[model samples]
Target: MSDRSGIFAGEDPFAIAQGWLSEAEKIEINDPNAIALASVDADGLPNVRMVLLKEIEAQSAPSGGAFVFYTNYGSAKGVEIEQAGKAAFVMHWKSLRRQIRVRGLTSREEGPQADAYYTSRSLKSRLGAWASDQSQPLASRTALMAEVAKVTATHGPNPKRPPFWGGIRITPLEIEFWADGAFRLHDRFRWRRPDPNSAWEILRLNP
Candidate 1:
């Protein structure tokens, strides 16, 4: 473990990640939970976008230490994730001068959990999810809003979660934490495990 101490001290990487996020929340101007989600397309080209980290699932039975986020299943990111079944993301906090990176396998979260989250959204947002064909070319904003209105009238107040819209859970195989240090040097720690239930091997890397 290389005698990791101070902010990097922790047996559980998930807990450490949550702690970093909590601290970032206090100082970040916006979207402290934002992550740059990365995936590969059919052509093997990389794609990335800023997405909110909805939940950090820590130490669970089926999978341990996963991050959760919601999106349209047919969206660009969703298509890439579904095709690859794996992804990586980085959460950087400028104010805290820290960044956390993760590489993981992914699976859809389209069960009751997805339903609950969908229902919790505002009525317009819920309808908009159905109306917007994310990542598709739109003729105009006015056309999109018209479609939104149509969906609102059709689905009414209580719209069920769309089959094509839900959450994705990423179970990380590798996680790296970086913190700023003096003289352009930095502190870096990597935690890796073969599978979700496997023991983590921590390493300190030169920065």
Candidate 2:
């Protein structure tokens, strides 16, 4: 990592990721924390969708750092992650012409942290989480809205975070950083380790 400098200079990949995202937030028009999450179904079919990245835990975290995002446990992405025990994602910033990619093991974060995050959301979002049986068929929009109304009635002003909805933390085994370069010769670096407990092996890859 002798050549690492500027945006890429950091002892922890999670810290570097946070710096890039912070920069993205200032220039991106919307959803600066959005990431294209990838997972596989029970049949091994691939699924990808955009999800907002919620937290990039620091290296000092008890789990040694991770990327966190929330979703319904019954959702397609959630079920896929549970079945396969792995996932990957990419976050790109068109304004900065840079992107970061990660692949890792997955686990649920449905505890006090999940409840705290759920509480921070708008009331409507909290109720919507209770109503939506994500990745499942719904007869019509009206039916869905009615269900939302019913849940709102039952839960009142302060509904508990649904057990079915919570966070997912990805403890990455590999992370790659790429930046656009002249004549399509992009600058690329990948940091990898066999597991979270091991030291990273950095490689500068040709692009």
Candidate 3:
């Protein structure tokens, strides 16, 4: 792994991903933590959208590690992911000329971690979570605002996290690190495994 200009010089893909993200945070103009999340619907149609990555858990015994983010459980992506029980995402930083892609199994994190993250958000956002019927048809902007106002009043200042809002964790089965190079000859190293419990098989791929 170290041969690829030392960028992928790590046994742990989670650690490498964390390192690349840290570098991106220093130089990327905005939303350095953002990832393009992908999921598939019941009919096997694909969907992708941008979301801020909330955490990158290091590799451990049981959980092994995961990428985490929050969203409304009833949203299109959430429903899609639940249907497929799998997801993928890509983190691309133009400033660093690097990208990391991950494909994995999905699971819910609706316990204390989800609650804590929800509490850390702004009051308006917490209320908004309770107000909007995400990915569903809305009558008008006025109607949406009115719903928000109603929820604000009902939930008050320190509202609890909505039952339908929580974290989604993606435990990667394959992770690929890619960096741009001279003459478009990029470097790539992929860590693949059948499941989280299995050992990784690393490969250097032609770019």
Whose TM-score is greatest here? 2
Instruction: After the best TM-score superposition of candidate 1, give how far the Cα of residue 155 lies from its true spot, in angstroms.
Output: 0.9
lDDT tens digits, residues 1-207, model 3?
457557777678898999999999999999999999999888888899999999999896356889999999999999999888999999999999999999999999999989999999988888899999999999999999999999888889999988899999999999999999799898888899998889999998999
lDDT of 1 by residue, 28-138 (tens): 999999999999999999999999998887775355678899999999999999999999999999999999999999999999888998999998889999999999999
- The parts of candidate 2 lying over 4 Å away from their true place are none
Q: Report the error of model 3 at residue 64, Å.
A: 1.4
Q: List the residue pairs that clash in candidate 3.
A: none
Name the candidate, 1 or 2, with the larger lDDT value. 2
Candidates 1 and 3 compared by lDDT, better number: 1
Query: Ten residues in a row with the worst lDDT in model 2?
Result: 1-10
- The full ranking of all candidates by lDDT, starting with the best, is 2, 1, 3
- Superposition error at 89 for model 1 (Å): 0.5
Cα lDDT of all candidates, in order?
0.93, 0.95, 0.92
The TM-score values for the models, in the order shown, are: 0.96, 0.99, 0.97
lDDT for predicted candidate 2 compared with the true structure: 0.95
The clash count of every prediction, one per candidate, is 0, 0, 0
